[model samples]
Target chain A: MTTNPNTSTLDYAAVKPNDTRAYSVRNILSHVFALVVAGFFLYAAYGKIGPVNARQFAVQIGNYKILDAAYSNIPAIILPFIEVYAALALLFPKTRKAGAILMAGMLLFFICAVFYSAIHLGLSIDCGCTGKGGSKAGWGVIARNTGLLIATGLSVWLYQCGPCAPKTSVDS
Target chain B: MKHIFGVIVILIVSVITGVAAKAMWYDTWSPTKAAPPQKMAWVKQQTSDAIAKTGADRNQPGTSGDASEKVTDNDAEVSDSSGATDASLTADAAVSNDEPEFSGGFPVAKLDMVVDHLINGTAHFVDAREEYEFDDGHLKGAHLLPSSAIYENIENLMAVGVLPGPGKPIIVYCGGGSCEASHNVAKVMAEFDYQNIYIYVNGWEEVMAEPDRFAGQTE
Candidate 1:
């Protein structure tokens, strides 16, 4: 199993099956990150879809006081589906980046809304982030969203570095 | 560019699926139609008509049992601030001597009484908060009667057979801390001729404070 002295170090590492393919740390980490994010978003969407209460969800949206009551219904109707689509898009290799982008954008919006409603307005209302029964939108929720944003960024970055990414490297 | 295309595709799919899902379970949110922009006078007329219907249809009482237990002194001479103070309506109301006397148009109930009503189904608990807050946790048998679109919400309420016209002790509560949602909802209830409406001022906050006792009471 020893590398021949004749082979150069760069070529030797490249030839190691463990190093490049089956055991690539970058690949596993990327998928793991994506899996976590996808699982989370899917779970969130499930909560919304399970109850399937658009009007109630719209009221939840209105609680943020960000959107006018009239405007809240459309988002409430569509947001859960968006989460599901984004999570699916992320799991697939072709649309992973796009999903990540969508997820990151949503997380950013949620963070701001939670901050404004829970922290700024001091409303003791539920966040409704993960559908019904979500906790109040407060500092703790802000921290959680921020962490999710970081994870989202890392998922895409790591995915790009993984073997699934289109490669332009030349072998020695 | 591909990423953008992929995102657009995802968005389109989401919109389509969302619409389908909304259609599939339209009943769950059909009540929210009240929030849309509607002719005010028309809505008011519809609401008044509904209220009149409710007012006219108040003959039957709740099924005999604990329902009759919450008898209110409809003719009680309560002060403005303590609307039901001297009424001593229910055993739960008289259970505690430390209960806060009302400070508003309606009588205020203590957490114990609210919890008791919840357990016994002695009163129809109407949650005055938004649907989302009600979803988080609310007293069992609580009606989500937010005051925003009272006309439509009440119609929805009536559709569900929850006619609150001068019958059971209607306990209305909201997110406590200086929140006026409960009071607003109570006023609307009064407009519908709902006598014996009690306000649980420290509603959600109090219920949330004692996680253990009220834990099982939430929907």
Candidate 2:
């Protein structure tokens, strides 16, 4: 019997007949990974969106010295909300791929920025990842962003190949 | 590709909505404020008190001499030993004399000059350290204006006399020579057209190392 893959439950027997249980476990793990990433984005956005924090975040962005004040204000105003949107998108199955892509892009940007600041510039300012009182930017922040990038990539792959994919009967 | 476009659209909408909400609720969107008019009454009082304390201390034999005399003496010594290890401690803990000019165009002051200003009460001290750090200890009479809150509280700082005005000499400092909080706060003050801003590069660590020279210690 064919089961609709998009309905949330994976017909694991049809998808991977030899290892239905393993397929099911993999599917569950993928969902968990997506949820965790979504939660992370949400938490990051939460710290950065308030009136006071948004301004502080702007200042932190200014410290990078890559962008002038006019250009810096644009990201300072939009980045947190984009983070919020990405988190919401990740929570919904239909939008998971888009969310994962956006998150990966953001993580890549962050990793690059952290690497540049820590290695090239030798700046010891706060990473400003989680707004005010953020920990200093260093190799550790790069490591964390790299890990999150890996998780996001995995989630995207799982969504494309697992339950979120279209289903077809094994006999067909 | 379509999905990516959709995501971009959503993000643009979200930013607009979020900014609109901020504008509605917060009353002002700009992070900075115009420089307030100069107010010197409270500054005069604080300066007088600081001067009196310095004068009294100078009378006690071991204290530094009068403000002008000390400034001249310290200036000579600072110019001579500008980059040398401070005589106060181990070589490892030497105060850094390489005070980089702040991007905001404010002048950089060495530890001795800062201490001189503190003694003479010619400059108002603004501590840009975090609240807990300020609580632990700070330079005597230093206003706790953490960098995070400087823009929001600029007016409050002015009202409370922590910032006397644009014309008053304001010395901003933080944890150490490398700490950016002092520079950041100084930048904001400069943006507000503060005329005589100075960054105390060696900051609280150097000052606290010799507590006898400076006054307030709340650790």
Candidate 3:
């Protein structure tokens, strides 16, 4: 009996043979990861030039030097789309990889910005990563981003491993 | 190829869901609490209550001794003390765009009243509207310092001979009555420790309504 190779690669005996457990932990992890990512994107999109002026966000982006005053308004308008797209991408299997890659890249950029500001800028300027009350990004922000990146990376890797396939009678 | 494709699909789904969830958590579920003073529902209730109470008190016959008189008297005192305080409070109800002050208070002011002070040279007028709007038309004596760049270009107000120092009263406004950009700019001024930062809630449109009273004329 020919069986699915991807299932075996996924490390689930159901997809392979023998070992049987009532439930696999993959489903729970996927749900949790999806919830986390979706929530973040939705939140960021809300404040993006909706009622709140883009300049407020520009001031935030200014701290990182990723965007200057001239392009400040542009990012504010574009941010809402980025957030909505990122959220939808994470929910769908076909777009998950692209979403993961994009999310990871953004996180990495944020980490770099925070670290750069802390080391070179000496933290005098506001990091403006979050809301108006957002504290200057520092070592703490770097650690937080690193953890989130790892989680996203894991989700992407495990997803590639494939879903657990039901075992076949060939082994018996 | 099929297996690879399936795996890709699942991964993509996971990512899309995750990002969406993340956005929702922060923007919606996380900070569900609405800011005060900006909630239109509450403001609406207060408006009706004030108007109804005033109407009812006036409708009541003698021995009530003119209840409407008492209401106007109170309104007069508040206005005399705070210059159009009742009107400004009503104006606050007009716009839902309330920038949460760092100190947690919604700033409001009467544009017509502020402009009156500016024209009389009693107060300095600062146009907190965007550059484009200011260029289109703004009060004559009003100097343009877009709200977006209030923090960065604040010194320009001084350069324009508008905002001289900390003690001088400053009246700030953006576009028309509905815009909160001026309110945000006023907050920035307050953050800078400007004690007398007045917000022109009625804005330029309302101020321009009465031609003679306004000092800064715009086409």
The most accurate candidate by lDDT is 1
Clashing pairs in 1: none
Question: Per-residue lDDT for B41-72 in model 1, tens only?
Answer: 44555545654443343223652334233323
Query: For residues B127-208, what per-residue lDDT tens digits would candidate 2 score against the true structure?
Result: 8876767777777778877765566567666775654323345788888746577777876665443435677877877877
Predicted candidate 3 versus true structure: per-residue lDDT over A11-56, tens digit per residue: 3433344322212456456646766776765665555433243446
Which is the winner by lDDT between candidate 2 and candidate 3?
2
Q: Which scores better on TM-score, 1 or 2?
A: 2
- What proportion of the true contacts does each candidate reproduce? 0.44, 0.32, 0.02
Q: For residues B15-119, could you state the per-residue lDDT of candidate 3 as single tens digits?
A: 555455445543452111322334434434544554455445444555233334444454422222222233233323333234312111334555545655655
Model 3 segments beyond 4 Å from truth? A1-23, A166-172, B1-219
Query: Better model by DockQ, 1 or 3?
Result: 1
**Considering only N, C-alpha and C atoms within 3 Å, which residue pairs clash in candidate 2?**
B140-B216
Give candidate 2's root-mean-square deviation (CA, Å). Answer: 9.9
CAPRI rating of model 1: acceptable
